[model samples]
Target: MTQHILGGCLCGAVRYRLTERPYNSGLCHCETCRRTGSAPALPWAGIACAAFAITQGAPVAYRSSARVVRSFCGTCGSPLTYFHADKPDKIDVMTCSLDDAEAFPPTEHVWVSEKLAWDVLGDGLPAYATGERET
Candidate 1:
């Protein structure tokens, strides 16, 4: 049996469902993620593009970088998903947006080179200084 995961934006303006389980669950401390989320790090799960679908309202997209696009709810400014043009097969969803976020714990830390000194999450998971571990 397939377990579907559901998530949405803060104001419920945008909703989504993952038809399959996510992988590469991790915390990203990259500068882009930090600035975009206004936080020290962002927790994300990788879902195949084909398995992800918008179930409700449309999300506004921002071209955060040449290779990446971030989507959010325009009304509530709640971050939703992250996509890389180079990797169209997968999309990263904010773990916090999930209906059962506690079920998806991060297994590693990525972009540790940009990690803030004060923001320490003592999970002792494998840390990647720059890029993520190849899945």
Candidate 2:
């Protein structure tokens, strides 16, 4: 999407390219997302798994759930991909990790209700206070 943006982990040990646009690009306030992102909200978007590839190193994986596996660079510890056991066909990418991050603006925000008061965040996108909200 946005003329095919590309990105990788901080160490360049992990790399990826995306030809299709990402859907649901916004902040997620769910507890699981917050832990992995180590942020008040995780900015992410869904993309077809087929459109993504690890062009570089073999990153390590951390299981967030029995059905979900999160990928990150073993060397740099940069959060990378979110693969789901149930879905099997798509993955969620961390938007801030993109090499060409300027290509997309968050269209919506999700899980606003779970956010801690100290972590104030804002964007023009639609905001929701719960995990059920779609970005």
Candidate 3:
């Protein structure tokens, strides 16, 4: 049996499916992520661009920076995916957008140093000050 990652926008205007499990998924609390997501950290799900596809309404784009961009629903305004223009073959999805978000839990926390004043990240996942783990 194959487990497909399925989900859509809040207003049901958009939907998508992925046949493969995320190669890597985690929570990111970097300043960029915090501001773009408007949350302490955005939970991400990664699937090969080839394995990811949207079968419904189109998602909007926000050029977060020169290196990164975000996609979301124009109707519901739900943050959806992140990707680097230079790295076009893959995307970091917002796990919350998945119909069954419980299928994926964060494996790690990125950018703990800039988390937030009142954000309590207590899931026991090893916290990283940046992308790499501290020695």
Candidate achieving the largest lDDT: 1
How does residue 82 of candidate 1 score in lDDT?
94
Which residue pairs show backbone clashes in model 2?
Answer: 1-20, 113-129
Find the number of clashing residue pairs for candidate 2.
2
Structure candidate 1, residue pairs in collision: none
Distance from true location, Cα of 1 in model 1, Å:
3.8
- 10 residues in a row with least lDDT, candidate 3: 1-10
Report the error of model 3 at residue 106, Å.
0.5
After superposing candidate 1 on the true structure, give the runs of residues whose Cα lies further than 4 Å from its correct spot: none
TM-score of 3: 0.89
lDDT, each prediction: 0.91, 0.80, 0.86
Poorly placed runs, candidate 3 (over 4 Å): 133-135
**Residues 52-71, model 2: lDDT tens digits:** 87777887999988888999
Q: Highest TM-score, which number?
A: 1
TM-score of 1: 0.94
- Candidate ranking (lDDT, best to worst): 1, 3, 2
